[model samples]
Target chain A: MSQILRREAIYALTGLVTVLMLLEYFFWPTAQPWAETIRTWAIIVFNISLGLGAIRLLMQQSMNVQKRRENWQYSAMLLSLFVVMLLTGFAGYFATGLQTSNGIYNWLFINIYTPLGATLYPITGFYIFSAAYRAFRARNVDAALMLIAGCFVMLKNAPVGEAIWIGFATIGNWFQFTGQIPGMRTFSIVGALGLIAYGFRALMGKERGFYAGGE
Target chain B: MWDVIGLWIGWLLMLMIYSYPLYKENPAFRTAEHMFIGVTLAISIITNFSNVMRMCVTPLMQGNILMIVPLVLGLMIFSMLIPEYQWVSRYPIGLLVGTGFGLGIRGTIKPNLQDAIIDTITAPTSGGAMAWFNFLYVAVGLICSIMYFMLTFEHKGPLQGPTRIGRLFIMVGLGGYFGNTVLFRFTMLTGRAQFFLQVLKLIPM
Candidate 1:
């Protein structure tokens, strides 16, 4: 297809999808069976995407290891654990008559993955502290506003300040409303709008990087 | 004994996984990241498929073959795997996008519009100074935030005042985000610490 034709095609398809979704949301069939069918299809599609993503992740890590990258060992460890987890999970599932309770999969997930995932974010506190010490300098207007807001919220959330000041909760609520809530909402709206636009572009085929050629 | 050993080993492994990044990137962390992603993806896929086959496809195949419309739609998604046949992928994409948008619009109205707005507006008239202040904040916050998205006109006119206030509200929001970030980081540290102490045998694991 020619460039202009491709762009037009992309726009048309994206618009169609958007309209259909809107229709489905508000005015689609109310029948339980049809709704369930859509839900099932959605689940299947989501799973296929998940499988594809895993394959891609493995490929990326293997490439890193082959190139002898700085963090290749992490990749190796990750792959090993992955295989171990998958085997245990599937085997345990079948062994226990498809029951998730009291299985190797559930055990590993609860004991290992959940803890590690939750912990990963927390462990970054050292970095955050270090980063804040260096970067939280109130040298400018915006930075100063940020510093003030951060300090207030931190104080309110922490148990120490509430003990010292009875009004900390009130102050925290005030700060949250006047400062954080509005700002985040606007930013989120902007983000959502951008995503919608890009989504439209992709649907229309105007965004084609995922495809083989630039076309 | 074996279960205990495995648990401890897992904990040690978790610590090493986080710690290795500090010293330098190594095969251990890479292996862990890849393995986690891969296994998580595989398990999720298998489970989801089993569920789908059981609930949707099996019943359809057994009784009403015409009920396999969605199954065909599901297959259309695989068109993405092909080069020239890729346009077929759009069929499924269209269905998904349309359905998601339609659902979101209907689902979002109550939470986003009526309850949040009406509740804020109807806060008690009689209260202590702090209570009155909070009520006002909620009312103002909702309005200012909504205004932040206005695009038709420049915020330079009467909106200049409210929009400036809106900007301040946004900064406050960002500050909350920063605080959350700090908390999140500490949580990560605690995870690593737990791994070291309980699993790695650095303390007990």
Candidate 2:
């Protein structure tokens, strides 16, 4: 009985929101005011919900510390840093009306957080090189073609390739414009159709994965 | 002076974090990883709170009663923490999903499907031989690629040819994408390397 009520609530809410949005799209003058209100509400709700992630993180890390688990010291460090950052942020916001630009917050962010974020993408460079060495082997006709095309495109992109042969750019551009765009467009269209179908299924309550435990 | 010192420290810490994975994962890497997650979450929470204050709280304080509806709806999300009333959380999820779908469908249909079809159909056929050839190539490629995704028909006999061509086009497209991605990653590495070199005064500007 409870499950049925939950499902019904989900359906009702979904249907209501979707219809409202559709009305906003089609009949702008009529639904504009209500739609704007709803949109603002959605944004507020979404932003508030973002803290749930932080809460979950705190819960897990605190558990690790409490249980004295292996690498619990790291968890301790994590929690301490989290508290310091959070406190500094709130304090800055209250004091200066800007949390991010506060001296301590700015220093920590620029020194620690920014560097950590920047390093993550570049680290993938080494991994991709390793993977390419294994994956780019020309074992068959299709593989050989792909390897040749990939090599051309890669060379065209690199400065050394331009120094070696200027024609690499021309060939690469031709491949991208003539070969890639059409294929990509078809994929995009297909994907969009899939999205629409999935949306409809969700609207009809045929897709219940959004419900916890898939109820 | 202090900012310069902080920048240098940042560069060194970044290098250490990145280099650890090349050898073997160690405690330093794990600590840094945890620190990153913690800092990120802290920043996210603060940012979200600030947004709520500006968008919802401020408006309500200014005598807007409508804000209460969303405040209540948003608060309902925390019900998930209580197992007995967890289902209440589904209301917000449903609304969000519905809004997302409605917006996405309305936005995607014209741009992804209609515009693409229109562009393909209106492709110029009355240029030089090369231009005409390019147009034909795009048209055929688009058709074949679209056909490849038609799961209703088995790729046998006459259907096999187009499907094969479609697969080849897809491979080429994916290869191009992969190459671009590799180049982008290399460029990022170069930027980091440049920063490190400059910080150490090893490279002249």
Highest DockQ against the true fold, candidate: 2
Model 1 chain B, poorest ten-residue lDDT window?
Answer: B97-106
Candidate 1 has what TM-score? 0.75
Off by over 4 Å in 2: A1-4, A27-29, B125-127
Error of 2 at A191 (Å): 1.1
Tens-digit per-residue lDDT, B85-193, candidate 1: 6666655565565455445555555655555556667767676887777677656865776676676778998988887776666666787789767766675676567
Model 2 misses residue A73 by how many Å? 0.8
Q: How does model 1 fare in lDDT? A: 0.63
The true-versus-predicted C-alpha distance at residue A25 of model 1, in Å, is: 6.8
**Predicted model with the maximum TM-score:** 2
Second chain TM-score, each model: 0.84, 0.91
lDDT by residue (B1-205, candidate 2, tens digit) is 8788888877777767775757778776787788888888889989888989899989999999999888888888888778888888888777678888888888899999999988877767577887777788888888888888988899998889998888877777777888888989988988888878878889863
Clashing pairs in 2: none
Interface RMSD over true interface Cα atoms for each candidate: 4.1, 1.4
Error of 2 at A91 (Å): 0.3
